[model samples]
Target chain A: MSIPQQLILTFISGGIICVIAQLLIDLTRLTPARILVLYVSLGVLIFAVGAFEPMQKIFGAGVSVPLIGFGANIAKGVREAVDKDGLIGVLTGGLTSSAAGITSALLFGLFASFLFKTKSKRM
Target chain B: MDSKAKKQLIKKHSPSTTILKNSIMAFIFGGGICVIGQLLSELYSYFGCDEKTCGILVTVTLIFIAALLTGLGIFDKIARHAGAGTLVPVTGFSNAVVSQAMDAKSEGYVMGVGAKIYTVAGPVILYGLLSGVIYGLIYYIYRTVEQMI
Candidate 1:
């Protein structure tokens, strides 16, 4: 696909995924936290079925930007690890692959907490 | 009014959500975030990083920006309107961690910030890792069986 086309697909796919989450939020009692957990697990299950790659290929960051993509990444990491290191990869691969994202979030989050105070939501 | 009638009255009077409008906002905001990610990935790729490195960099950059916004109190403001638009992306994950930490800063570092930082996002990480392990084991067995056969 062309650059513009790929970007458009990314936008559409990302938008659609968020829309589904919105619908869940609006229509159901599921909290945002639960929904996020669900999405991540859904990503893992989708990958388990061997479908996440093609979806990523088409949607690009749309599929990859969500927590679902994170789940899939962990699964992917484990798979690769298992292949290369035998059974030990089952325990080591997921965190190993996701270390960059997880570590960055933790470091940046801690820094932000020091630099800024929380504001009460404006009623 | 009787209890049943009071319940009916309360349910009737409560303000209803603007579902259509919220969905539209979510789509726009969520899609916009992804577009930004795509652009960032492209930029990194142009700088000669491999695809995997670019993906990692894009996530790191997004998380950093999200953490900043959450700290500045801007992300929640936007999230008020964006709803799941803000909540569904990786940015939302960053917000969860940063917001929780900031909220608990009053209780000091270890007992407060440390304990509470993952209160919200812990499930995502925990379940994410759990499912990955489960799937990995399954995949390993399947592959092994395939090879044996």
Candidate 2:
């Protein structure tokens, strides 16, 4: 797709994600943990069934922008590993690939936590 | 089953904290897990394993470390320190499974290990499945239109 198309897709996708996440918080009893996992897993499963292919093709970043994109990456990594390692890839492919994102998030989170004082509920 | 038993469990896990600490912890804990992964990958290659084998080690190592932390009760402490951070790792993933299992100790091993463990993340799994289906259908329809155009 064209650059313009890609940008538009990303904007829409990101907007949709934020909107849905907010709605879930306002409407459902589900915790944030459940929602984050849901978004990631939804991305993976959608990509696995070849459902996200069109979006990915049209708006590569758009599909990849949301947390779902990370999932797709995980699925892709696992599939790639399967060809090389067969049975073993089934176990480890996702972790090795997603490790960076997880780590980055963690590092950034820790740094942010250190810099800012988070309120303690009990206190 | 009794309030005393429930209180016992809470004591075992750390008490809840504020959202700020939770997010802060989320970042650190998640970051820590990632560092562990890097370390594991290095170890894998250090032992002369191929990329495939290293990949397998990555997951195993992450899960094992997480399980160990959970068993040691460090996971609960970390969770208290960085709420979502702890939940975001492979280890965090293990904690989610085991913590619920701990809650269901009265249900016996099979039910506790198999059924009850998923109680915490079940809704997330269900929602993810539903969203994936919805997103796929939407993406497919739009793609067909683009192809025709």
Candidate 3:
């Protein structure tokens, strides 16, 4: 609730979330890409079950900044759209919900490509 | 001693990895990034945007910053230290795609940048959208049932 308390909670939650991913990377053969997808899908599932909102409320960016938060945002958007538009919402809701983030990434990414020369990673 | 046994002994005696130090670094760096996001959110709200729109603006700005960093090749250096700290944020997702596109630019244009753009992030987008549709259907059913009851 207070500023200091909020900071502490965000730090702990953010660290713990990263730790889980780090452990998965260190302990298993799962590639980072797979783990990332898993995180997103798991977030959506958690959100659907009505559990993610409380975590988001308490942790703030601790929960919201993570990829799971992104997934949850999509689900939240779809739910709102479905309420308003029915079956059609099911198809468009996710994209509409995250359109801002996705579109910005695409446009900025393309802009960066033109501005900066690519360097191959040394093998 | 045989070379294998000697190598094993050296590994056993090697100093343990500094998990605490790494975690502390991640916490600090990751928290710093999130704090930036929070500040942006506050700034947007102050500029008269509603809460939802403010969040969108913050996210768009972060994605832009992250993509720029990835293009400049600094994000990789930071990632080596920050690890999942950077990867956990939406910026990380932008970094993933942009870095891939940057790397593939060498091979050619279409098959290179355009095709490989989604290689790493493709699964995330696929699964994320899939989950959204699934959740939407379930929520729709629940709402319908609740109204009937």
Output the number of the DockQ-best candidate. Answer: 1
After superposition, candidate 1 runs with Cα above 4 Å error: B1-7
What is the C-alpha lDDT profile of model 2 across B35-148, one tens digit per residue? 455456557778999855664566555655555555454666656555444454444555565555555555655664446656744554445444444444444455557669
Summarize candidate 1's per-residue lDDT along B27-116 as a digit string, tens digits.
999999999999998899999999899989999999999999898889989999899998999999999998888888899999888889
Q: Higher DockQ: candidate 1 or 3?
A: 1
Q: Candidate 3's residue-wise lDDT over B1-149, tens digit each?
A: 89999999997998855666666666767777776776676678789999788778878888888998888778888988887778877878899888777777677768887788788677888899999999998888888899999
| TM-score of each model, in listed order | 0.96, 0.49, 0.87
Interface RMSD for candidates 1 onward, in order: 0.8, 11.6, 1.7
Q: Can you list each candidate's DockQ?
A: 0.86, 0.07, 0.59
**Model 3 vs. true fold: TM:** 0.87
**Per-residue lDDT over A102-122 for candidate 3, one digit per residue giving the tens place of the 0 to 100 score:** 777766766676678866554
Interface RMS for model 3: 1.7
TM-score winner between 1 and 3, please give it: 1
Whole-model lDDT for model 2 versus the true structure? 0.54
Error of 1 at A35 (Å): 0.6
Clash pairs detected, candidate 1: none
How does model 1 fare in lDDT?
A: 0.91
